[model samples]
Target: MDDLRTIIDKTLKQYLNAKQTPFKDNQLANYFRREPKQYIESYIKKTGFHFNYDVKSSVGNGRWAIIPWIVLFDTDISNSATNGIYIAYLFAEDMSKVYLSLMQGWTYYYNEFGTKIGQIKINAALNYWRNSLNLTSSTFSTQDIHLIDPSKRYDTSLPRGYELGNIMSIKYDAGQLPTNQKMEDDLSLMIQSLEELKSKLISTKDIDLSNKYVLSRTNIIKNHKRTPTKRDYDQQS
Candidate 1:
């Protein structure tokens, strides 16, 4: 309920203050997957779409990552980051910057086509989606992101794959994050394009809306208020 700007600034500081030792058992690392992540969910709940999300300080197991991330997925499209298109907030290895990117599930393409050909398919999907969407934000970049550090060797290809998956993105630097109003406005703008894309998928593929298997944030709001109209009830079922 506090201002989102305040929360984001605080979270960024927290990340920086503890960046050097983001072990799995570290409390600061755990905070990324817990409270801050929930706050982000609460803020974005105004969008009305349901999303699945996760934050990682490590590649997996005990392997700490240089580029940590928080990601949100619209299951109506795909449930996991490994196999579908989704949105993510990627933090730089040095904590100097973060990127809000519309990215694809690269491992899926990599598995199906090998890295060489998978990259080609990823580019194809990127072009198709960018050309089809109605996004009006000129601020978003489709070019590149600064997630992988060139100086350090990485054990996993996740970071490189993430870089290759970028379809569009907006960058925010440390100490230069916009005001709460601006941040919310930007998120809402991106969500509009995402929602429209979702609608297109449903209509074109004849995908049943009921197959989404998730609760809309609007429904969550109604349920929390303990007041729901008959129409709302009907929609839920």
Candidate 2:
């Protein structure tokens, strides 16, 4: 895992430098630099110094995008007969970024734990953690959950083959964090709309009906029918 993380971090640095858009805020960058100070503080408080953390940068978008950092902790605390926090980080630039980062994080965890027992344990833990963070969602379909599991075939191990079912069966509560899946979905829609607009602009040689509603409502003098208004041309300009 450490080797994989190092390779990813190196790739990210090269990608960012190639784009010439390093993050603007050094402090924010450092907040995600390795085991973040904030996460360390929280872990210390929760488990009373028995736990330690390992941090790594996972993914990043272009200059205007958010980056994710993963944090894995060793905990002496036990929940459901398993030992320690075993937490993973999905730190990002905002709520929307956090949502995508978490999806990526779950993908990584699922890949790492490929066995039935491992899958059962990790799925339950993930559901509990999300709920504890107040990150439960009605929007997460079974298809979405299946996407995260590398072994697409479901057995008795994963319960209803969704996070909520795993958590409910285990009877564990984590609490709420924050949810931004809706915002992420909305942003995706906006990007798609923009791409469509751009395609239309490229394909059309003339602007004919731009602001047609307003032009149709305007009164024209004389008995002749009005010509198409100049606003169409102006829109092209």
Candidate 3:
């Protein structure tokens, strides 16, 4: 737990010290992608719970350029390899919103050079999620179709829209319970805080640091020279 706190503190500090550049958003996205598995693992450890979660991403143009979706399930008690508790589903309009909410202290760093590096990271993450879910569909459906009546195979009364191209999915095993709970709680809190901060930023139209909350504590190591102490699985059990 102490190590997890230290890692988060260090990450947050790096985020704060990072210069606010046009492409900082892209940088931030890359930062998370580089250590995604580790980050998620730490989150699980801290939460002291396990769960299964899926994430997906797709790209387009304008506001619809990037989309990310996530679904979470609780770990199954009977089978560690399969089954989980149903958690929540999340859908983000773009990578920026996804990062701002899920990854604290790492937003707007990848918006550099009018490039879509952040979008690429999102797609990669989505791919990871899809692989985890073992989805058979090579291409996702672009239309939203539903039948009004369960007895009828098709419904004529409902309005049908083409499936939006960007979509992804994931599944979790029961063995991942503790860590999953921690991640979910942390992510949920971060999202709520980010929403409030975003609303304030929009209202004030300010980009100054003074206006933002000090979400991270200072004192980050200048040199990335620390070795993480490994936990003993046998001892833990």
TM-score of each: 0.74, 0.27, 0.22
Q: Which stretches of candidate 3 lie over 4 Å from their true place?
A: 1-29, 50-65, 69-91, 94-237
Give one digit per residue, the lDDT tens place, for model 2 in 49-161. Answer: 33233333433332332334343333212111112222323322222212211221222223333344334434544443344343334433222222133545433332222
Which residue runs does candidate 2 get wrong by more than 4 Å? 1-20, 23-27, 38-49, 55-67, 75-85, 91-94, 97-237
RMSD of 2: 24.4
> lDDT, candidate 3, residue 143?
25
In the range 26-132, model 1's lDDT, one tens digit per residue, is 77666555655566677666666555444322323464556667676665565555655667777776677778888766876576557775666567666666777
lDDT of 3 by residue, 1-237 (tens): 233233233333443233233333455344433344355455556655433333222221122222222222222211111111122222222111121112111122123111243333323332332333422332222122121223444332111111111222122212222353454555544333323333333122222131111111122222223222333423322
lDDT of 3 at 205: 27
lDDT of each: 0.63, 0.31, 0.28
> Model 1 off-target regions past 4 Å?
1-8, 14-19, 22-24, 47-63, 202-237
Candidate 1 residue 12 Cα shift, in angstroms, is: 3.8
> Candidate 3 — number of clashing residue pairs?
33
CA shift at 20, candidate 2, in angstroms? Answer: 8.0
Clashes of each: 0, 10, 33
